[model samples]
Target: MENCELLEKCVFFNDKMGNMPSTASVIKMRYCREDSSGCARYLVCKALGRENVPADLFPNQEDRARQLIASAR
Candidate 1:
């Protein structure tokens, strides 16, 4: 995932749960700062030597995606 995508998936990256009720619309940031200073993903990315994850990292991407589907959950 790119920096944008990874940042969006952060557990703390709540976008007001969609929008403000009064407006019924989502107000999004026009641009991303693209800094990893305040997120756990920061350490992971630092260790990986990239601003973006490369189809890896459980918190960024689903861990299930790393393996074949299991017969039982």
Candidate 2:
């Protein structure tokens, strides 16, 4: 599947699990930040780009910040 589609699926999975739909949380839970730079919004945006998804789906700083906070919990 395309990256955006994959991302959407990943988020859906997170939602289903009652977890926050943020990459950082998933990364921390599954892969931890030490192994990587953690899950950054830019990476998600890039993945969306790879899937030809609209950038507007995830505006930018605002969305990222919101996701980050949600994931921090």
Candidate 3:
């Protein structure tokens, strides 16, 4: 599949994970490239808008993402 449209702009990858390239690479492959719809950041961005997506949110934190989405509605 194509990479996430947010790949270049994602704060998690561009800033938060910049110190850990190897780990970031693996995560990017899984969530950003393979399946962006499953990414927590992507979910929040879709549900609440990019401005509401926390900078600290991680791709694996789907539960938290869901909570944020729910709270918004």
Off by over 4 Å in 2: 1-60
lDDT of candidate model 3 versus the reference: 0.92
TM-score each candidate.
0.23, 0.19, 0.91
Worst window of 10 by summed lDDT in candidate 3: 11-20
Which candidate's lDDT is highest? 3
Those runs of model 1 whose alpha carbons end farther than 4 Å from true positions after fitting are 1-5, 15-34, 37-41, 44-73
Candidate with more favorable, higher TM-score: 1 or 3: 3
Q: Is 2 or 3 the stronger prediction by TM-score?
A: 3
Cα RMSD to native, each candidate?
Answer: 10.8, 13.9, 1.0
lDDT of 3 by residue, 1-72 (tens): 998998899888777777788998899889988999989999999999999999889998999999999999
Candidate 3 lDDT for residue 46: 92
Clashing pairs in 3: none
lDDT over C-alpha atoms for residue 36 of model 1 = 37
Top-scoring candidate (TM-score): 3
RMSD of 3: 1.0
Error of 3 at 19 (Å): 2.6
**What lDDT tens digits, residue by residue, belong to model 1 across residues 1-73?**
1244545554324443344543322112211234333333444454443444333333323333222122121
